[model samples]
Target: MRIHHDWKGLSPEARGATVAMGNFDGVHLGHRSVIDAARAAADAPLGVITFEPHPREFFQPDAPAFRLMNAESRANRLGRLGVDHLYELPFDAVLAGLAPEDFAREVLVDGLGIRHVTVGADFCFGRKRSGNAQTLTQLGRELGFGVTVAPLIGDGRNEYSSTAIREALADGRTRDAERMLGHWHRLDGEVVHGDKRGRDLGYPTANMAVGGLHLPRFGIYAVLIDVLTGPERGGYTGVANLGVRPMFGENRPNFETHVFDFKADLYGEHVSVALVEFLRPEMKFDSIDALIAQMDQDSAKARAILEAR
Candidate 1:
């Protein structure tokens, strides 16, 4: 998929796309429904209009990290959903200052020349959030474009939303989060070199930093791993520890996965690890032997859970 970073200029082909517009943080089921509406709206290119750094992040820099997925992960998911163009417009003071009608006139009409736009029913836009779905529709009619406000989706009980997914993840309800997400809750990052403690313990790991994200429960989980880059790009089932290494005196959380039956060196490779089940909460072992024994148990449980899939 083609990713455009700005809306200022465009070749004819990149403009006039029937696009889904929003933050698209996780590209969860609700986000997908809006995208589907856009795809089904017209025969133009399938596009996603989103902002970099997310508006919330920009406006509230001191707030705790609450994003479900990072930009790279979000892009990969959107590409997999068959997006032809991703207009990842920069979010900044100038963009934020645009009035509702000016945003519709400048960004949507003149800047992008979008043929149609599909947004969720609760979508709001412009400076100080002065616009709503109804505002966009009226603007679309006056500005010569089509607009679709997709109704919110629910799973009989709870609405499919990022907030609900975050709540489920925070409680270690991986299955519940997956139900709302329509996929496993995943963390994607490049494998970086670590302390090699897992290696010395006979359970080698690929470690990834988990800063600037809404963390799940600190625990061990049965995970499905996808090696997204380099020569060993493929799928693997593994047991992952998604927490700070309390035994090692580390306070920053990291994702450390031991790919079962795999012997590839994965440093610097991008991998996506999907949390399938929460096996246990984080705990420190008094001795290396005890940790190894618990790791063995975790591996066995993970294998059984994944194999059953």
Candidate 2:
């Protein structure tokens, strides 16, 4: 998909694209509905207009930094969803201060030459979130563009949302989060070297230094990892520990995955891990033998879950 920072980045041939505008944090089912609507509106290419760093992160640093998907991952998912263009606008004080009409004029009309636009029914934009879907529809009529406010869709009981997904993860409910996300929650990071304690215990693991990625609740999980590397590169269903190794006296969170039946060195290599199901909560083992026994149980559980799925 073509990506642009500004409308000028669009060539003479790039006018008249249909746009789905929003934060698109997770690109979950709800977000997909709006994008699908834009795609259905023919005579224009499908485009997604999203913000970087999420305006919430910019305006309120102290706010919980929970995010369903990072910017790059969001773009990747949107592209897979058939988006022809993904406009990741830099969110800053200047852009944040735009009036409703100016935003429509400068972004939707002038920048994108949008032939049609789609957004959630509750979508709001412009300075202080003053603009609503009604405002967008009204402006579209004046600007010769079509506008659609997609209805909220839920999995029967409750509406699916990124926030809800995060909450589910925080509660160690991978299955619930997957229901909303339409897929397993995942993270990508490099496999850095670690204290070799797992090796000492006869259970080697690939360690990744956790960063800003929103981690799931502290627990052991059944996970599938794709090693993006050499001839040994492939998918592996494994068990992962995402917490401080309390049994070993570590007081900081760590991510260690033991790939099943695979003996490839992943040091310094990047891999993406998808959390499939929660196996158990983090527990302090009285001895190394006890930890190994619990790990054996976790591995068996993970294999069963992965195989069943």
Candidate 3:
């Protein structure tokens, strides 16, 4: 997919696409429903209009890291969904200052040249959040473009939403999150060098930082790994620890994943780790041998869980 940073002065190729506009944090089922509406709205190109730094992050800089995925991961997901154009517009001071009509006229109509736009029923825009789906529909009437407002979606008991997914993840309900997400919850980043404690323990792991992402339950997990870059690019099943290393002396959180029966130097390579099932919370063992024994049990259990799928 082609990603455009700026909304202005597009090549003819980038203009006049039917696009879904939202933060699309998790790209969950609800978000996909909106995107699907955009696709069915017109025969034009399929595009997604989202914000970098997420408008929430832009407005509340001091807030906690709650994003499900970073920009790279979002782009990767959109590409897999066959998005024709990705307009990741900057959420800056100038853009934030626009009034409702100004944003609809400047960004959607004139700048993006979008043939149609789809947003959720709750979507809002403009200074002080004055615009809603109804407001956009009215603006579309005047501006000669189509507007679609996708209704809320949910399972029987609860809504399919980012907040719901976060709650499920925080509670260590991996399958619950996946049901809402339409896929496993994944953390994407580069493999960074670690202290090699796992290597010494005979379980060499690929370490990834959990920067700015919402923390899932602090536990061991059965994971599906995608080595996204470098020569080792492929899929693998493994076990992972997604918490601060309690055995070692560290307070920062990260994911340490040991690919089953695999040997590859993965430092600096980009990868995506999907949490399949939560096994247990991390614990500090008194002896190294005890920890290794527990790890063996964890790996065996993880393999069984993955194999069953």
lDDT per residue for candidate 3 within 1-309, as digits (tens), equals: 999999888999899999999999989999999999999999999999999989989999999989999998888888878899999999999999999999999999899899999999999999989989999999999999999999989987766889989999999999999999898999888899998989999999999888888999999999999999999899999999999888887798988999998987999999998999999998999999999999999999999999999
Selected candidate, larger lDDT, 1 vs 2: 1
lDDT (CA) per prediction:
0.93, 0.84, 0.93
Please give the lDDT score for candidate 1.
Answer: 0.93
lDDT of 3: 0.93
Error of 1 at 126 (Å): 0.3
Q: How many steric overlaps are in each model, in order?
A: 0, 0, 0
**Model 2 stretches astray by more than 4 angstroms:** 5-8, 12-15, 228-233, 267-270
TM-score of candidate 2 relative to the true fold: 0.89
Model 2 per-residue lDDT tens digits across residues 73-179: 67657876888888888888878999998999988888778889899999999999999999999998887889989998998988878879889999999988888
Model 1 weakest 10-residue run by lDDT: 153-162
**For model 1, how does the per-residue alpha-carbon lDDT over 190-256 read when each residue is reduced to its tens digit?**
9999999899999999999888899999999999999999999999999999898887788988899
- In the order shown, what is each candidate's alpha-carbon RMSD? 1.0, 2.4, 1.0
Q: List TM-score per model, in order.
A: 0.98, 0.89, 0.98
